[model samples]
Target: MLRERVAETIYVFTSSRYLEVAAGLIMTPQGCVVVDTLPFPSESRQMYEFARRNCPAGIRWVVNTHFHADHIYGNYLFEGIPIIAHEETRAMLERVGEQALEEAKQETPELREVRLRLPDITYRGRAAIRLADYNIELIHAPGHSSDCTMVYIEEEKILFAGDAVLPVPYIVGGDLNQMLATLQKVQSLNLESIVQGHGGVLLRGEIPETLEAAINYLKKVRSFVHNAVSKGASERELLAWDVEKAGLSRVPLGGMAQELHRANLLYLYRSFQKERLRRAG
Candidate 1:
């Protein structure tokens, strides 16, 4: 895990072992608020230790931005802290968290110790948390997932944009249209920096370009998939659409960006195919 203090009171930890996924901590006068937990127990425990040593006030809350295993798997470490998240997040976790954990543990024995921790505090649309001088807003930004949310420190203009705003926008189990709307919503924010769910943090100067590229990539994917579907293209042919052709690089996230792009292509292709069949019926 790699740790970097993005702001005076905010720290981001990037997991070296897993897709470069990130977790964040926001220190407040009352106590530190954890944004999300790293995938592995060892890394998250390190973050927990860091908070214990640095923040004398202790941890006030744990915010699970979404229900993805990589984001919330280590929630057990926080123990008693009140967890805040979207209502649907809790529902999804309740529906499938245990089965997912069991499957994960079967694949990796290291995950055997992980326990499912559902969010105790949930809301719809949005929620606000005020600790001392910091005003934190949890905005519902569905794209990467239905329950995807972003954590904005109103005073600092820093955003912890869960998986909704990644180096390469992924909508495999998400809505492409929703992803576009969410990207537009993010573009409207006056942010000093954006801490992505994966990869490096986006500074002020890098925000606009990064967002525009993602937006453009999604648009291109939609168009390409729709056109291919209209022409009765086979799934294999649609899957052959290259990431660079959609105006995105295959380099981010240590070349995992290419794989994410492929997944997006497959998802959009199937969605367009379904739409066509519905129209024919």
Candidate 2:
């Protein structure tokens, strides 16, 4: 795991082994707060140890930005603390996460040690965790997933944008419209930077251009897929839509960006096909 201290009390941990998934730690006078966890316990445990050694007050809470296993699997390490997330996230974990874990363990034995830790504290729209000097705001920003949440530190103006914001907008099990709306909402925030769920942190100077590129990529993919589907293009043809052509670089996240971009195009193509079928019916 690669750890970088973004601020005086804020630390971002990126998993070097898996898709560059990012996690965060916020130190306060009261205690420490873990934003998310890594995919493997080995990497995640490093984060726990770092927090224990650095924050003498102890870890008060574990905040999951979403229900994705990559982000919440290591919650087992912080078992006692309050794990918070959007209500939908808890529901999704119960309804889908359980089965997914069992299947994952079958393929990857390391996941056998993981236990699903549902968020004990769940909110509808927004919630806040007030520390001595920081107010951690949890805002519902469903996009990458229906249960997506964004963690914003009011004092620092740093947003831990789960999958809601990434190098390329991925909507495989998510809604394109919702993702677009959420990106617009993020654009309106007075953000100093953004800790993306899957890549390096976006600094203040890179914020505007990165966000604009993501927004454009999402819009471009949707329009391209919709047009191709309208013209009755085959799935293979639609899948050929290059990531670069849609205004996104395939180099981010160690080339995983291209794969995600392909998935987005395929997802949009299928959704457009479904709409067409419904209209015909």
Candidate 3:
């Protein structure tokens, strides 16, 4: 069921296992704009029904913050709708979306079939759409992914930041510098509320402080990797070094420490390789 957080204006739809992540819906007189469609079709339908009852106008726009399966798999649920997303997002979806859906089907036969539908409308830098009651601004924040974008409600001052601003470092496949730059760009926005693709909503006032912490964490991870590389540490050794430096040995395998820190290490490794190549050149 969708929980009414700020009335019909904003709603949260969550999954059982994915408690850290919640899809958001914005209601307007014209229709409803959904941000980050959940992974499963059932969850998407639940969100759709909630929005229909709350708005009843229709779903005019569906925004896939990124090309992640969990975010865009629900696009099939809103087929024929004018889905809007970043240009990179559309490209990535076209490239890998089908494979993701097929893989999911093989893994979960009981789940409803969801097709991979690329966004019909895509914007490069930024795009602003005027809905029935509010203006939705799509800002390109390429951190977590090349196509990651943040949805900003201008009047409400609420930003639906995809996986860009999470509580922990979830830098699975991204450039560390680019992600840091994206976070800096997001910090510059005049936002009153920050909603992450994963994790609960955060007030705007808390953003600056939280952003600082995130940046510092990334820097520390980078430093650790750089120093280890300088000492000719292997990947396995680097992993152990990270565990000691970050004090992440206690968290569960699938928990924040493991997932987030693993991604951070991968990013650090890539960054180190790039720096080494530049120095060699």
lDDT of each: 0.92, 0.91, 0.77
Local distance difference test, candidate 2? 0.91
RMSD of 2: 0.8
Q: How far is candidate 1 from the true structure (C-alpha RMSD, Å)?
A: 0.8
- The TM-scores, one per candidate, come to 0.98, 0.98, 0.89
* Candidate 1 residue lDDT tens string, 112-220: 9999999999989989998889889999999899999899998889999999888789999999999999999999999999999998799999999999999999988
Off by over 4 Å in 1: none
Clashing pairs in 2: none
Candidate 3 lDDT, 18-83, residue by residue in tens: 545667888888888888778777778888777777778887888889998777777777767789
Candidate 2: list runs displaced more than 4 Å.
none
Q: How many clashes does the backbone of model 2 have? A: 0
RMSD of each: 0.8, 0.8, 2.7
Worst lDDT run of 10 residues, candidate 3, spans: 247-256
Give model 3 RMSD, 1 decimal: 2.7
